[model samples]
Target: MRIIDAHHHFWKYTAEEFGWIDDSMSAIRRDFLPADLKSAMDAAGVDGVISVEARSILGETGFLLEHARQNPWVYGVVGKAPLSQGKSAVEEYLAKTLPGADKLVGVRDVLQGSPIEVFSDATFNDGLSALAPHNLVFDLCIYHNQMQATIELVDRHPEQRFVLDHIGKPNIKDNVLEPWATQFRSLAERDNVFCKLSGMVTEADPTNWTAEQLQPYFDTALDAFGPKRLMFGSDWPVCLVGVEYPDWLSTVKTLADGLSESEQADFYGNTVLKAYRIDAD
Candidate 1:
């Protein structure tokens, strides 16, 4: 199927920087570099991956670009920089860091923990403006509650290509999908926006989540964005907190089993290549 894991991460894990890895996520507390992910991808038959930034630091882009340079399977990178500082900072950061980072196809700033007001901030929207000129996709990583504000943000940037990370991070833990589903569909109405079918396991009961519990959310994403705008993502090391790499892949396959061959292709790889503008060659 030419599968590309559209979202995953590579990190030299440390408590200080990866503080989000609370005691519950102890399994992924150690280093997870290209070699570790290579093994997992090989076992799961994943052809390549887009390494998303785990830390919202300037150095993270370079670190991921280095991994992509060293490993052919690391197809592209979703980097991080000072996006909230406004357009000038984004321009300067890209000018300095993007010199040789051809593998860096996108940028992301952690929106999951930010105040909802950040979504409507003019400076942040300006920063998002800076990415369009460079052809960099801006990954939206907000929680489900922030969807309305994000819809506004996406509305502000029609020229920008935005990938909605984790399907707006719906609240699967409590089986709540009201406002999230409504807001999610509204966001998908924008043609420039795309969605990644990753990070669902962690959003659910990590230890006890069943594929059945995740079905509706996936169905919602499929119905909203369809195969063309929806792509598969492992969410990797974070996914390990809930399900093993291979099991997650299996679950996704089962959930998406109704897709025709071409639809499967779009969901698995084609959407990623189109969204990231990754060169298939």
Candidate 2:
């Protein structure tokens, strides 16, 4: 099977732009360029990755696109744009950036910290409306609290494809799963939405987390989306705060051991290719 990491990131890290990388994440304070990720990928036997956006800037998209142009292992990019600014803004951004960006497969805005109302914002939905014609998947990066709002947004655009990043970022630290589990399964009812099995370790108790603690959440995702709609993602440098790349990949492998060979193939790679419309050839 082709082992594509459905999500990861590349960044020329800065304290100013990447303020989210606070002191706790000191391990990743410097920079994580394509070279850094190449080493990790080689170690894990990952075939390629879909490089996701870390900063919400147009330049971030260009940065990823340039890296993709240089690195054949970068299968695709999920970059950011000013989508909340309205439809015209989204269309204009796409017009300027999409011409030569063959690796650009999707767009993401960090909606986890934003107000819930933003999901229902008419202008924002208009921006989403603009993507379907171009066939861009929108990577939804939100907290568990935002799942209902996310469902509402998904209902608005059945034609647009969405890949949920980090499995709604459930509260694994406390082992709390109710509304998150319920809402997650609810969201999965829409075939247009897909989920990434990434970033869970970071959301867990970083110092004392165990595979046992993560298995329930993994089970929830599997039960919700099934293997075909769920994809493997390393979340890379960000995941460094929680666990190493190879360890996380191994954990996911063990968690997915119950799947048949065909199911494993879809979970590890094929699902991402279809969700992002990436050409494996």
lDDT of each: 0.93, 0.92
Question: Cα deviation in Å at residue 158, candidate 1?
Answer: 0.5
Lowest-sum lDDT 10-residue window in model 1: 119-128
lDDT of 2 by residue, 1-281 (tens): 88999989888877899999888889999889888898998899899899999888878899989999999999999998788788899999899999988889999988998998899998889888888898899999999989999999999999999999999999999999989999999999999999999999889977789998999999999999998899999999999988899989999998888999999999999999989988888
Q: State the lDDT of candidate 1 residue by residue for 102-191, as single tens digits.
A: 898999988987898888888888888999999999999999989998999888999999999999889999999999999999999999
In order of appearance, the predictions have TM-scores of 0.98, 0.98
* Candidate 2: regions farther than 4 A off: none
Give the C-alpha miss distance for residue 70 in model 2, angstroms.
0.3
Candidate 2 CA-lDDT value: 0.92
